[model samples]
Target: MAKIEMKNPIAELDGDEMTRVLWAVIKEKLLEPFVDLKTEYYDLGLKSRDDSDDKITYAAAEAIKRLHVGVKCATITSNEARVKEYNLKQLTRSPNGIIREELDGTVFRAPIFVNNIQCCVTSWKKPIVLGRHAYGDVYKNCEIKVPGAGKAELVFTAEDGTEIRKTIQMMKGPGILQGIHNMDKSIESFARCCFNYALDQKISVWLGTKDTISKTYDGNFKTIFQKIFDEEFKAKFDAAGIEYFYTLIDDCVARIMKHEGGILWACKNYDGDVMSDMIASACGSLAMMTSVLVSPDGNFEYEASHGTVQKHYYRYLKGEKTSTNPVATIFAWTGALAKRGELDGTPELVDFAKKLEKATLDVIEEGTMTGDLARLANPPAKQVLDSWAFIDAIAAKLK
Candidate 1:
């Protein structure tokens, strides 16, 4: 039989480590055989990124912007250790950060639930989607290490030379200073994305921030979201029988413990990074989460919420079989394909994506999974296959 055809190409950003190994195998086994895959491929591997002076990362983001659909494999975010390990030209930035900034997007992460793998949090009957503001804050920060005593000040100078200065700290000894910033415009965009997503999913939007402490900084986010919701989305939300509310971060955390999920918990940049992982772990493994970046202008980029399986990759390099979970990665592909098909008006392509996802979940429900999920499986996975074998099982189910 002929493979299902795609009307347009997907911007495929490839990555590193064990998941990178699984990336090619997944396409060869699960996707290529079943679909006429068309993608503008960009190698976001560390070595390639260094060789291109990180231009490839930007190019890939541009491709996603142009195509309006992207599927990314988890890539290594370079650090001092990574720079030496890969012999990189310099300390390169996170490819995910670059893409998120380019797209001006919000990341929505939700766990992929299977019947056999129970949630650690018993109260979570439904999936709790985390809407993360993907721009600014600690991800883009400035830091300085003081040698001795000095004064630290935050000064803003207007174009007309008007100056507003505030004292941060008066250091008496060696210390460090860090500055983080967020834009009003970016916050506005983040608010719209969350509200739009909530309306689409028919879920309540609960934004959490520490406005009482960092009155000005956190207050801005709260203010923007409230203004946008009240001025723009309040009516629509009321019509849909849904609601949007702002709460202190502490209260949100406490409420989440008792809530039955099914809420889009929108968070600021740093908060989202931490909470999303917490949410993912409580639901299941980090690899069980699906992440998607949605730009306000309708662009979508799907990726696994977890990082590259670096440990497994090292073992794999020594010619050992590693059972790394590839569920989130597979879902990333399905997500991109489904969106592509939906946008292209190709129902067949969308159907194929849905079938692939079902096949994956069915295999897990039948107690066939990799090492990571095997430990977490409630009834115990009947067959603990290596990564390749697990994909093969799903392929068989797909066929």
Candidate 2:
């Protein structure tokens, strides 16, 4: 049989380390036989990034913007150590964070549920997708430390020639003051991204904020989300059989811990920053989580939530046996391909993604897993295969 052709090819973002190794295998084992895939590859590896002065990340993101689908690998976030190790010219930052900021998207991380792994929140039968707002709150902040007695105030002057100033506090002794800002445009972008994602997925959306406490900072989020929901999505929610709810931050966190799944949690930058890590731990291993950047315009970028697996990469370099789990990386491809299929009206590739995802999960359910799960085993499951072999197990089933 001739290989199937997909018109909606992905703008592939290749990265470093173990994921770099797995990228090739995923194409060969999962994608090649299924689809005659076309990829606009950007070498976002450490060396290439240094050589390109990280222009490649922006170019890659722009490519995604143009093409509407991206499948990215986990790249090395060059630290001082990495700089010495790679023996490079200039220090490079993390490609993932840069691409995300440039694309102006929200990251939605969903755990890859497999029967073999035990979820800390056991009730999460379905996926609980978190559309984390990545723009403001603690990430961008103005700070001042009072050496002497001083007043901390927030001043807002209206366009109608009315100046409003509020002095929140007067420092008794040496203290700290802060001013954080989020542009209306940024907040609107976040709202659109979450609304677009929830509507696209047909999943309920929930927004949480500590509006009761920090009325100004958190209230901005609440007001924007409400405005967007009411103006754009109310009737659509009714039509689509999905719901939207707003709750206090504390309540949201508590509910998230207790509730099962099938709800989308839209959080502010800081909340997402904290909760995502918590959720990652709760779901078991970071390796099991998959992060996807959903642009406001509905472009997609999928990658492993975990890092480059630096330790495993070094061992693999020494030609040692390494069972670096490739499930998340595999899902990244499946997601991009599936999104491509959906956009292009190609049911074959869409079905291929679903089946490939199921195959990976099925392999896990059968207890044929890599080192991470093997270590996290409840009764310590005996059978353990290395990385390539485990991927082969998934591929054998995919075939």
Candidate 3:
């Protein structure tokens, strides 16, 4: 069969560890044989980032801006241990963070639900997509560790030589102080992105923030979302039979547990960061979660919500067979391809993407899965395949 032709290239951001190993296999067995794949490839491996002084990361982000679609493998976010292990010159920042900042995108994470895999939350019959604002707040903060007792103040200086200051705290001994901020532009971008995505998915948008306490900070977020929805999205939302719901973060959490899924929960930086993980685990393993970074302008970068399988990679190095799930990674490619197909008027490509995803879920439904999923499968898989074998299984089922 002739390969499906692609009109535009996808920005492929390659990574490290076991996912990278599966990346090559997936392309060879599943993608290359069926599609004339064109990708603006960027090796985002740790060494590559260190070698290029992280220029490759920025370059990849730029290419995605031009191409408008990216599919990324899980990469390492350098830490103290990783710094020493990789022997890097400096602690490299998270590639996802860099791309999100460059594109000013909101990260949306949703689970890949399969019939055989039981969700810990038994009431969740549908998927709940978590839209996380990926900028500002505690993720980017200034902190000071006070050495001794002193008065701490929050000061603001205007360009017109006006200064306003207020006491933050009076410490009796050593303490800590932190200052965090969010830009109005970024917050507005986040609101628009969530609303746009909700409209695209035809799902309700539920925004949660602690505006009752942080009146100035969280209140701004609530205000911006309400303003945008009322002015820009309310008509569209009502026309589509969808609703925009806002409540305190605590109430949101309580409601989420009791409510059936199928809504997009828009959260602040810290809340989203924590809630996404909780939702992922409650629905299934992190390996079953698919993530996409959607910019307000409609550009997208898809990826797995999990990290590089470093432990599995180490075992593989020791000649051990490891059963690491590749479902999310495969879905990442399919998602980007589907979007590429939709934009480029290639329905066959979109069909192939749909088939690929169905094949993956079909494999799981057949009681053949990786270790993580096998444990949760209603009837445990008789035999769990390793990462490569699992990909081969899905390939055989791709039809």
Top of the candidates by lDDT: 1
Each candidate structure's TM-score, on Cα atoms with residue i matched to residue i, is 0.99, 0.86, 0.96
TM-score of 2: 0.86
- Write the candidate numbers in order of decreasing TM-score: 1, 3, 2
Please provide, for model 2 over 100-193, each residue's C-alpha lDDT reduced to its tens digit, 9 standing for 90 to 100. 6777789998877766677788766777888887665665566888897878788988999898899979878898888777777778888888
**Model 1 CA deviation exceeding 4 Å by range:** none
Higher-ranked by TM-score: 1 or 2: 1
Stretches of candidate 3 exceeding 4 Å from the true structure? none
Candidate 1 accuracy as lDDT: 0.95
Question: What's the lDDT for residue 5 in model 3?
Answer: 100
Evaluation by lDDT, superior candidate among 1 and 2: 1
Task: Compose the digit string of candidate 1's lDDT tens values, residues 210-262.
Answer: 99999999999999999999999999999999999789999999999999999
RMSD of 2: 3.6
Cα deviation of 159 in candidate 2 (Å)?
13
Model 3 whole-model lDDT (C-alpha atoms): 0.92
Question: What C-alpha lDDT do the candidate models reach, one value each?
Answer: 0.95, 0.83, 0.92
Instruction: Please write out the lDDT profile of model 3 over residues 287-337, one tens digit for every residue.
Output: 888899999887999998888999999998899978988888999999999
Q: How many residue pairs clash in each candidate?
A: 0, 0, 0
Q: Point out the higher-scoring one by lDDT: 1 or 3.
A: 1
